[model samples]
Target chain A: MAAVALKNQLNAHIASMFAAGFLDKQFQELQILQDDGSSPGFVSEVVGLFIDDAEKITGLIAGLLDQPVVDFDKVDALVHQLKGSSASVGAQRVKLSCEQFHSYYEAKNRDGCVMALALLRNEFYDSRSKFQTMFQLEQQIEACS
Target chain B: MDRRRIRVLLVEDEEIHRVVARAVLRAAGVEVEEVENGAEAVRRVRESGAGGGSGAYNLIFTDKQMPVMDGHEATRQIRAMGVATPIVAVSSDSLPPDVQAFITAGANDFTPKPLTKEKLGHILAKFGLA
Candidate 1:
């Protein structure tokens, strides 16, 4: 009964993510891939990787922005990578933020880039929190099972 | 198609992409080898091509944006060495211009990033490996 409740909660949370546009079809694809039995815990593994990579990229971006002479090329490259990473995991909001970041990056507008980075950071953290919640629910369900 | 198992060389700088792609390919029973960047990919292709078929891969999937060397240059170098293996560009950029650029760079095919089993299947069938 407890596991059943946890499972339902997890499903609801996931549905809310999609409904809110925090995730997209790519996340469903990841679930399908995990279900294939080719790799157990694949979703969790990917979420973990995404978080680590996002953190590192954002840190790099922040550092670059702090420099008196900003290297727009390097910043753009990092953001591009972050966008790719977010897309792979279906972090829709974060990916969009990265795309917006690119425009400012292209213009070499440091202020705009800073604002974009903040937006990206917010999306990344929100998505990361949701993922963590999902993981916890999964763990509880597994324990009940 | 030969009865031998399909082998693929995956050239990607990102670890998450590598993990995802490798899982998909392995699920389809395809053998996979990974390299981090285009330069390493070039070296791997060269070495395998020189190994007299023992280490040769049937297909190569390369990400277009990477450090050290990008996929376009890698594809160009591989083609220059006269390698006949099917080279597929796997990238997030899938627009017409992107596709044209990949083809211009000598890629045999273009598949967008976040590769799915179906997409990979089509690639295999298209290349006569399926």
Candidate 2:
């Protein structure tokens, strides 16, 4: 596709993500930084970091949950870190899921925590796919531009 | 005082936050030095001296959550050393209580994170560094 068309496609796709509540203004802030030459590939770099960090945290949560004596404090702290990471990258859905996960862990409700983790995982995977798609679109635009 | 570009120390564990904040600060013509946590922040302040010297920072920006030490403790420690350099707490966790805690711990100001050029400009202006 031509650069303009690809750019438009990217914008529309990003708009859809925002409309779906998968992203927020902070993501746009990142894009602005990228555009201003503050940091080339800023968005992709941050998104990549978020994905790597979230994956590790998710695995840690799963391991903690599987332990016979679950350490709710540790789980909560990990979830909090995940939430902060999500917020940093403007991963709204994942951040919201992490917030929901908080109440469950806070109450020391193992069942609730398990259920919330499933939801959190689903949201995170969905957000990750969306980000990946955006990255591809950006790459296409860059290639043609 | 000295005629030099404003210098700021950025304390944030998250790499992305550090990247964004450094970009914004550098764009504003401010010199930035970064550390991943508060203990390093304290050490940097101590080693460089906070008294408007040749290598001292004019300001400090720190996140609330970190591994070795939190912003509150770092701010308190820096203050304890009698370094009056302005410390601004930059965080996403900006509840009233959190802001109050930062102030009580000796932060000169508080700003929400995903630090923007405008927000940073306001901070610099507030501290007369702009």
Candidate 2, lDDT over the whole model:
0.87
The alpha-carbon lDDT assigned to residue B91 of candidate 2 equals: 83
- Measured by TM-score, how close is model 2 to the native structure? 0.91
Q: Report the Cα lDDT for residue B27, model 2.
A: 74
lDDT of candidate 1 over A1-145, digit per residue (tens): 9898889999999999999999999898888888886566998888888899999999999999999999999998899889889888889999999988988989999999999999999999999999999999999998898
* Candidate 2 clash pair list: none
Instruction: Point to the candidate with the largest lDDT.
Output: 1
- Name the runs in model 1 displaced over 4 angstroms: B1-4, B50-55
Residue A98 Cα positional deviation in candidate 1, in Å, after optimal superposition: 1.0
Best prediction by TM-score? 1
Task: Please give the clash total of every predicted structure, in order.
Answer: 0, 0
- Estimate, for each residue in B14-129, the C-alpha lDDT of model 1 and write its tens digit: 99999889888988889999999999998998887533332478899999998899999999988888887889999887789999999999999998888888899899999888
